[model samples]
Target: MWCFDNQKLHMNMAILETQSEGGNIRDSLLLTCQSSSNLIFGIQPKQEPLIRSLSESELRQMPKERFNQNEFSSIKLSKDLKIRKEDIILYNRESGILRDSLEKDELLTKSEKERRKTNREKFKRALRVERLHFLLPKKEKNLKPQPALKIDWSKSKIKTNPDIIKVLKSFYTNRRDPQFPTGNQKLLLEKLAPFPIFSVENNLRQIILAYPPETYMKNLSDKLYDYYYRLYEWESDTRATSIGFFFFNPEDALMYESTIWKYGSLSAAELGTRLSFFRFSTAYKLNRTSPPEIRFLFIPDVKEVGDLVTRYRYQYGKQMKFHPNQKITRDGFADQPIYTIENVQLKQGLFSRREVSYFGELKDHKYIFFTVDGAESAWNKFRQANPNLRLPRRPNLLVYNFNSFINDCEMDPDLINQNFIFMLNREAYKALDKSKQDTPKVSDFSIFIDNRVKPQLFLIKIWAKRLKLVLFHAPRINEFPRREALLDGLTNFFPPSLYRVK
Candidate 1:
């Protein structure tokens, strides 16, 4: 079945090949796998014909030249597009006006003139707005002149100080929260425009990581995985909730903690108390914090089981339907008429189970989750082949203590208390224990899986733990389906080539 659209790249070539000689097709694939040094597998011999058919016999015979031609052509085309040498079409306001005046001398209808005038005004207005946004400062300041009635968008309650709004507005426009926008925060910001959840978690993650580098790294992984797992689970509970689903970045929590650290001089207990009050109160008034729309599943033809092999349908569903149990009805995705296949691979020798999972989606995108199967079960054989192998932990969330981090600063002895050192080690111990499963208590310090922006949060935990940061990320969904796909895809495609020496 060939999935074709007017769009060039949307051409999906599906070739279901049958062997002409019936010479064990599996052996051919196995031969290719061995000869190619495992660079090629998951690809059945049936799929090989598709590639072979695309190549000329001469090209196939001259593998070296063929490879070079493919590489050179691809690189040259991409480079040409990026650095195309062309004469610039310069347009000057004065020259355009002069040309228009000259054209008017030939002929001008009253309606045409009026339409042109209206268009000119509209263009000018748009230009004005663009310039205004461009000139706006990229960094947010704690202090800014505010309207007489200042209100924070997150919490609509009137406040004497309107600095938070100023901060948010800057972040919204610049895509950066200047104060605590570190490396992880920057990555979250980059992804926020495409996936709004990054913005939500940005502040929350910042606070958790501010604890201590060592502790945060240890516990952040599992806690982060648990966060998304819960949200995906929630999507299955009801469509209404799924419809209103949103995401936040983990770094935002860190940003929030940094703000408290920099501006407020209160103890950890006081800071936690103040934050809890502020969060609850603001949530009531402003309805400020909500997840962002990460992806949408618009299934126009889900009525046919066969049509389920489209990538676009899967992409939309992967973003929207977090839990496999959360069934998206055919009627739920009727709005978008045009559809394309987005994820059409297998996992464990079968198409992914209908169980809704964000990790499933990530994996589909990154890895070709395909395995061989036939009359005898392949899973048993594969397991027997690697009996001692164990799957790596999905990912973990780490929480850090802020009080401990500041104490390590070279000047901390003069400015802040060093008691945080002991607190951080204790928290780190609790987070790293594989046997511990207690929900974090709301004491002087608190940590939990950030439901929003779980992958970004998991990555942050990975980075922090590797660096021994004291932050605990709450466990969320194990792996975002898309993320797994991306990681494995890179691994499969980006391998080092081995040369045979004569």
Candidate 2:
């Protein structure tokens, strides 16, 4: 058997070749034989074995440890490692070898990008829905239907109570007399008759003398008491030839005149005869107290009283004295200066003590005064101008030419003292708009008027203090009972005690 050590083969071969020249015939013979075998068989020299290259798929599946670093050093990491279509197109775009593949992958990558974008939008929408679900009230999501509301039409309407109507009718009818029948005589008789034949003339005299002097004399403050006593004493001593009597309602004047003529005496005995007539007729007309109150005036002479009666005309009436002495003044006047703004100037003349009048256009629309007379006049004028003009009521705060108010004031300054003074011009109101809408302070009206009228303003302030004039703003236009509310301020000035005569 031949022994072979492959590791020492090269050294043995070299030794054999070197020993060939120095004979060792067997070694030379062996070398010649190997050379002859190489020639004869056409055998080539042996070289190291070549490594097998892996395909792209095989490299991806190959274990990491099995990979040869030296063999893969020249290959790009992106090509050697598993690469997505998007990465291949992005990184290998410049390689002409991969141009076709990269172009094909471009479509896939675009679709993949769009798919991811769509998924992201869906996620955002879901998040928004979740957030809103947390914010909404649970009850709102399950709301139940509600029943319709109901109102009783009959109850809502202002139907007059039968009981109230019966009471009012009885009240008025009981006071009616048989001798002095009213327009509704049939109704009065049916409701109130089987009664006495009442004498109003005798009743008037009795009512006048019913109260003791103390009723009129007491409760008056020291200043008012002194004033009254002075007038009473003056009248008693001077037998003050004449006295001035002021009547608020024209009907009251008529009643007094008719009663005195019929009964032949100016006593309170006759009050009952015509009291109902006076009350019913003047109930809606006068804003002041009903059953015309009395205010006494003691003048130096009876002639002055006559002058006043004549000057007052419909508002005043006279009667002659049959006896040595008689009371001169009669029922109190309801004609308050404040209520009759237009009559203020004329009413000022009726004040024997002092004359006072406030004259100014209301500023802005802050204060509005609507008069029944003015509204009627405006409606009538409007109807005249356009015969077809229709309105529910007179238009409230109707704008009128300022000249009309100015002319009315100029013609009769007395009328300016009314509760409502129409502003003839917006410009004039703007001019007077400096004062605030509050109670007319002493300084407000006093400083506003001309220097010549300052004393009169002072006197007005003093009178208001004595009378306790309550201040109020008139109700807005369209307010129910606007006129009545405007008149309420003057009501405080006329107490029942002030109206009572001793």
Q: Which candidate ranks first by lDDT, i.e. highest?
A: 2
Question: Lowest summed lDDT over 10 consecutive residues: which window, candidate 1?
Answer: 25-34
Off by over 4 Å in 2: 1-273, 276-374, 377-502
lDDT of 1 by residue, 296-412 (tens): 221111122223334324533432122222333553422212111122222444554332111222333311111011101322343345445432112111112111222233233
- Poorest 10 consecutive residues by lDDT, candidate 2: 1-10
TM-score of 2: 0.15
Q: Candidate 2 residues 1-502, lDDT tens each?
A: 0001111111011112112233422111011102111110122444332222223343332111221332212223333444333221112222343444523435566776666456444433322111101111011124321111111111221122234554454444421121233333323223222211111212222211112122222233433533432322111221111112233222333344343433322122112222111121222112111221122221111222343334432332221111112222443211221112221112324654333222333322122222223333544554455443233233322222222332243345343233332212222222223222322445545544533364466556545643432233324443333333334433222111011111
Models, CA RMSD each: 29.0, 53.9
- Tell me how far the alpha carbon of residue 365 in candidate 1 is from the true structure, in angstroms, after superposition: 38
Per-model TM-score, in order, reads 0.15, 0.15
